[model samples]
Target: MRMLHHGQASAQVDLAWFFRVAPAKRGAPVLVVCGSLLVSHTAKPPARKETKLTAGHRVAPRKVAGDLLVSGKAYANPAEYGHSRAVRVAVELGKWRKELAVFGDRVWLPGLTGSSPSEPLPFTTIPITYDRAFGGERFAWNPEGMGTGPGERGVRLPNIEYVERRITSPSSMPGPAGFGPIDPQWRPRADMRGSYDAKWLAQNWPGMPDDMDPGYWNEAPRDQQFLDGFRGDEAITIRNMHAVHKNFEMRLPGLTCRAFVKKTDGQLIELSMMLDTVAVDMEAEHTELVWRGATAAATPKLRDMEFLFTMLEPAGALTPPTGCYAIFEALRRKTYPTPEEYADDTKQAAKVRAAKAAEQQAATDKVVAEALTYRDTQMAQARARLSSYKHPSVPANAETGRHFSGIAGTIGPGIPEFGADIQAEMAQNWKMFAELFPSDDENCTWTRERVMKTHADGGDMSGANLSGLDLSALDLTGAKLAGANLSGVNFTDTWLQKAALSKANLSDTICKNTLFSSAVMEHAIFKKAVLTGAHFNRTQISGADFSELDLTGLNFEQCAGAQVNFSSAMLKHANFRNCVLPNADFYKAKVAGILFDDAVLNKASFNDAIGPGASFIRASAENLRARGADFRNAKFTEITALRCNVSQSQFDGADFSRAILTRANFSECKLKRSNFDRASLESADLSEAVLLEATATNVKFLRASFEWADLTGTDMSGSNLHEAGFFRTALKETKFVGCILTGTTLAL
Candidate 1:
């Protein structure tokens, strides 16, 4: 049957086999199916019949439907409108009824979405179906009144919508009365999900005709002949339907094809499509051989494959063609070779499976043996005390531990205790383990070549000793190095982010500029290691040791390092912003220009540290210590340093505004030029402190001590000194305006 766009004219339909019909001369026309449309092309034929589909034959009786008329005009007959051709077209309509036209001499087949043809005048007019509903007027066959009105002149075609930031409705097709502004910016509703798959088309193409009936095409029955191998739900996705170059792709059992239409001519002119299949040749080992019962025969060998080849074709105007059937039939006549030919029996298959399992187990055992050998060699070298053997840089005094508190922290208390001689031997083994791995090589592991080869062969070395390796600039991000011995390893500029280093030994390891962001390093040792410019953002460093390290310019943002040790360390310009470092140890640390902003440092220690230019803004340091330390020019704004022991410290040029230092000790501190405005120093001890040129305005000094303190040129105005003792104090030139001096002793 012939298809109709607006029930106007008719063209010949031919179901010619692509490989047999297209002319071999120069460049012949061919139809190729690409995704959704049928595209046409003109390409030169091969010199020889290279395709196995050369034996394919054309379908019989290619004439689908005949005899039709449109708008009372007669279409071209087969004798004049070239030769008849067959076209298989599948249309995708979401929801719409098929538009029907008049039927007379030659019946018009139901179209994808639009109108059918009328009467006996050599039928014409092909239909193009889209997967959507574009509301407009339908093309009617007006045989009685031709060229009467504008509607009778021609049929209108729909246009695609442009999804832009803003959309303005056309003034011609104005919205209903009482509607909002006509040029209002278009916005997709939440329920609509997006504009592409909206039920109603809101924006129409300007200057484009809308002739499609939104409610039609849904009731139309599809012809099975045109949809032979189609999955019955063939439609381009909403995202790709409006693309500039549209293609419909599909794969059948033994064939593949693409359907598309040419748009260079600016019109939906023709359906172009292509199809492809394969061919093979085979023979049995014996002509009279029983193919099914030869498995028990002695020395039975599988049949050999003779030849295998591919066959490509251009299925021009072939709607549900018969050439595909012939190709598959030829393939069926031959037997394809497979791996089953070798095994043939269930027992053989089981043997193959067991062999593979055994091979895998053997490989795993080999790797384990190699790793043991490497570890033993390292231990033996350390015991020999050979001059040629190199050792890792561990803490000088292992008993005191370089960073953490005691000996147990250095070599891990988890290590079993031994006698004196055995302990010495173990210590040497751990210290010298770093010599086995190379620093500059990519394979920086114990027994470098062996470990490297093992890893390449997909072997596991989770607990491998990689100590003292020069692992600079190594890309080990997200590597599973948990529980690995990484002591004295040089990780300068290495990518260790998101690596599993939990409980890993990183003692005395140099980590300059190393990236450990988001690493799982809980309880990992970093004692006495220099960690300058290291990135530990969002790392899990809780229970880890960082004591006695020079950690300049280190970034620890969002790290959860509770109870972590930073004792006696040099932390110049280090950042601990938004960290959860409660009970962290910073005793005797050199914290110049260090930042602790928005950090949770509750119960942490900073006793006897020198922290110049250090910031504790918005930090929670309740019950923390800073005794005998120098905090010159430090920022403690909005900090909670309550009940802290900051005795004998120098707070010169410090800013403690909006800080809570209740019950804190600042005894004998030099507080020159310090700003304590709006600070709460209730029940605090400031005995014998030098407050020269200090700005303590609005300070709450209730029950505070100022005995023998120097307050010369200090600003204590608008302060509440209730129950405060200032006996034997040097208060010359000190401002006491608006001071509450109830129960205050000012004897000096």
Candidate 2:
């Protein structure tokens, strides 16, 4: 037999003496002879004789050649044969043959004999071949057939066929032989005998209860039960073990097996044998036996000796097989579907996406078609309207006698006779026609030459239909075009000085770099108009709707407007100097770097406006509502802002020097490092205001409340603080030198 060492080296070991010890009863003389015995031929052999020897009897020792012999009365106990109920012996002896003679002579016992002189005590002559002892060479030791009498059934191993059938069968193995509990009726497909079918197992296997199930194993939370249960240390251990199993391959170096014995009273004893380690678990006791060759005599005894099921070690690594426990778990969680089902699902999803795309395309096509129809209809109506404004023929003047050609040099040939009276009448007729059909369609076919000629002939073009006409670089001075439908007209670089455009619809007009100096454009609609770099100097635009516009860097110098809507407009760096814009709405306007110098902005709504670095110097902003505004670093020098509510605003580093801010609400304001020198803040509420390091020197603060105000490092020297409230105010390092502080409330 070949014995394998720790280094995987092989050594030849003769195993002939393994079955030499004969089975004997208790207190009986048993001989344990090892190795072959040689007798000398020179001397005659001693004859066998019967002798009565009592217990503990001893015989004198004798020697023949190199052989020594000793006889004594000895007893043998079968219970002391091995420590465990089963002994696992790993051997690789040569192929066994039938009828192999182990011993030639029978063992003679002189103590017990019958009266039969011809009969001798027989030695065990049983054949030890693989076919007779273990049924086949593939068979290993079976604890079920151990401790039986000397016969064919004693050495028969059953695990060879049992493992083969269990691994190759379509159905799951029986409960006692399987690793864990499984549904009895569940079976794998015929084609999945050698491979694992995860989908099939998921649908068939019974999972844990809803409270214990961990749900689908993915990287997100799906079910509440999974979120609650799949946490803490137990989940961490499982994840770690799973990762190790996936990353590393483990294998047992030596023989391994598992066996379980059932007692008569239904108690089971499970045993696992791996190399020299044996782990046995009984119903009440668990023990681990380590087999050291020299110390094998000290093992503890076990109760049961009969095994119900036995397992042989597989031929590969110790990693889980195809249908292992890990596979079972993944199947129960339904982590993935079968290949065929997945393909079908993908195809259906593609169809759904294609259908949705088709619907969206159809809707877009319908909208485009409707827009084209509307444009065509508007164009037709505009053509009909323009036809009604045909120019009237002029009568010949007798004084000039040349077909009324008083201004023939300017009027080209092949045109009708031109005269001041006829031109005046044509202008009046066109104006009346515009007032009759005043539609801001923007598709009016008014050529640039026609508009210029009408303006040149007469300045009375009131209620004219000049929509969408490009009058760029034209000087339309002193023109009367009030109530005109001038929507979408391009007036780029045009000088409309002294033009009357009141109630005119200039929606979506492009007025880039245009000049409207001294124009009367009251109550006009400038919605969505592009007025980039346009100048409205000295113009009158009362009640105009200019909301939500981008008027960046535009000029409104010396303009006069009342109730003008500039809400939500982007007015960055815009100039409104010397303008009068009372009750104007600048709500939520972004007026950064805007200039409102010398403007009359009484009762204007600048609420929620963000205008950092703005200059309002010498502006009259009485009763202004600029609450919650961001005017940081703004210049308000010499401005008169009486009764203004600028609360909850950020005005840090602003210059309000010599300004009049009487009865203003500056509550919850961030005015850090602001310059309020020589400013009049009488009866103002500075509650919850943060004015750190602000300079209010020589200022008037009469009856102003500084309650809950933080004035750290402020300079209020030479200021009139008469009857001003300083309750709960933070005045750390505040200077009040040379100040009139009479009747002031300083209950800090």
* Model 2 residue 376 distance off true place after TM-score fit, in angstroms: 40
Per-model TM-score on C-alpha atoms: 0.39, 0.41
- Write the residue-wise lDDT of candidate 2 on 1-748 in tens digits: 1111111111211111111112121111122211111111113332222233110011101111110011111111234222212111111112211111111122222334422112222321222212222122221222222212344443222221122232222122211121111111122211112222443222211211222211111111011012121101110100001111211111112323333333435443343321222111111111111111110101011112221323233324332333333433243224344687678768888999999999999999999999999999999999999998966445433444674566676766644555766998999999999888857754456688877877899856678888888888999887788999999999999888888999999999999988888999999889999999888889898998889999999888999989999999999999899999999999999999999999999999999999999999999999999999999999999999999999989999999999999999998899999999999999999977999999999999999988668999999999999988775578899999998888764421
Predicted model with the maximum TM-score = 2
Off by over 4 Å in 2: 1-445
Candidate 2, overall lDDT?
Answer: 0.57
Model 2 quality (TM-score):
0.41
What's the lDDT for candidate 1? 0.54
Q: Which whole-number lDDT from 0 to 100 does residue 519 have in model 2? A: 93
Tell me the alpha-carbon RMSD of every candidate.
Answer: 33.8, 36.9
Q: Candidate 1, residues 1-748: lDDT per residue as tens digits?
A: 1111111111211112221112111112222112211111112211222222222211111112110110111122234343312211122223311122211122223456644433233223222212111122231211121111245222221121112211122112211110011111111111212232212122221111144221111111121122222222222111111112122222212222322121323222222222211111111000000000000111001012122112233333332434433443344333332455434545677899999999999999999999999999999988788767776555555744655655556676543554666989888997788677655664643754554455456565567798877777777777678888988988899888898898899988888889999999988888767687889999998888888888887888899978888898888889889998888999999999999999999889889998999999999989888888888999999899888888778889999998999998888788999999999999998877898999999999999988658999999999999989775567899999998889764311
